[model samples]
Target: MTDRVAIVTGGSGGIGRAVSERLAADGISVLVTFSGGSQRADDVVTAITDAGGRAVAARADVAEPAEVNALLDVAEAEFGGVDVVVNTAGIMRLSPLAQLSLDDLDAMYRVNVRGTFVVSQAAVQRLRSGGALINFSSSVVKLALPTYSAYVAGKAAVDGITRILAQEVRGRDITVNAVAPGPTATPLFLDGKPTEVVEHLAAQAPLERLGEPKDIAEAVSFLAGPARWVNGQVVYVNGGIV
Candidate 1:
């Protein structure tokens, strides 16, 4: 953990931006990877850099092994070594299990499931001892919400991978865990939902509000830094929703 470098995929998005910035605030160098929203990603880097933090932006498709490997190589060459890798790159298409298109499910699986696999495979090689790998899961798995079967199916797979990988890396000093976020105020969650629906979900939480990106980022910051003892766990940041 000499350099304390972190590679955050989908680093342009709301939660990703917060995580990158928070980790940088903690004195960790960040390698932000984005597939789109290049300008947004650059803005995050600039914010971190202006604050005297080290950060760089790169393009990588989390689903592609070569691209993911190249992205990690960028971190190694630029920041020395990777201490944390957070997979936040994912897409969701809402549809009932019966009406869901195979294409939508396929696309989500490619980016969400295979993407996690590709990145984790690289982490399996690149992450040093004492390093941590954080994967994103959804509280929907436990909520058992309808029209989420396909998305939940993919995330359910992530849950399995997180658990098995934790055990597989037994002696390695590496901690593998999944951060299951409840309905948060990210484009991924807010988009396509009506205000009433959003409000309904928000009120369901014990906290009586939606989670901010900073809230979720705080969780990742803890896991990536001081929460070394918390491994193979699904820490839900859903404000006591489930």
Candidate 2:
């Protein structure tokens, strides 16, 4: 996969950054994308390049089809063609079903569901044979955690898209899969939670600890590169949280 390229949305976030660096380490050129954090994305590029890997940073709103198409243009222009597309861009606004704000719920769906759809559509059209599209879901979909109904609903859409897209891409040798991570030690998961709450969630996993970003990245690396037989499956990377 030394000559292959990837486009990773939300590439500046905790899990996104880990996946970006991990792919680079595996000899894949990465196009690191950020919606607002240009500096953070650039830092990821710098880290990759400084480590003797290849990377470039750009800004693109994953929900916008035009912007996503432009990103594909950049990847092809920069590194020939895209072989992997990772949809890590998502948002979470916790509220119960009765109390959930429509605005917040719409925001999550826009970024998590619609954003994944836009990018996946583009990837299915543009990715070369042997390519892979990895979408993001959450173990919370199964865990059905309180106050996460809206967020889980959006990810549930992602699950459906992954399964259908894999079948739709038949004979192309391209795989579509979703990674549902359980409680992990990312800012997205840790931001507003109390320490005791975090500890309790961590202990719910058989691993008895919070997941590191690298743990999820490892699963992504497999799907993106060598795991050709793995397709249309939602691999849970949450250390047995179910």
TM-score of every prediction relative to native:
0.98, 0.99
Each prediction's whole-model lDDT (CA): 0.92, 0.94
- Give the per-residue lDDT digits (tens) of candidate 1, residues 1-242: 23699999988878989999999998999999899768999999999999999999999999999999999899999988898999988999999998999999999999999999999989978898889999999889999898999999999999999999999999989999999999999999999999999999999998999999999999999999899899999888999997
Model 1 spans with C-alpha error above 4 angstroms = none
Clash pairs detected, candidate 2: none
TM-score quality measure for candidate 2: 0.99
lDDT of 1 at 85: 97
RMSD (Å) per prediction: 1.2, 0.8
RMSD of 1: 1.2
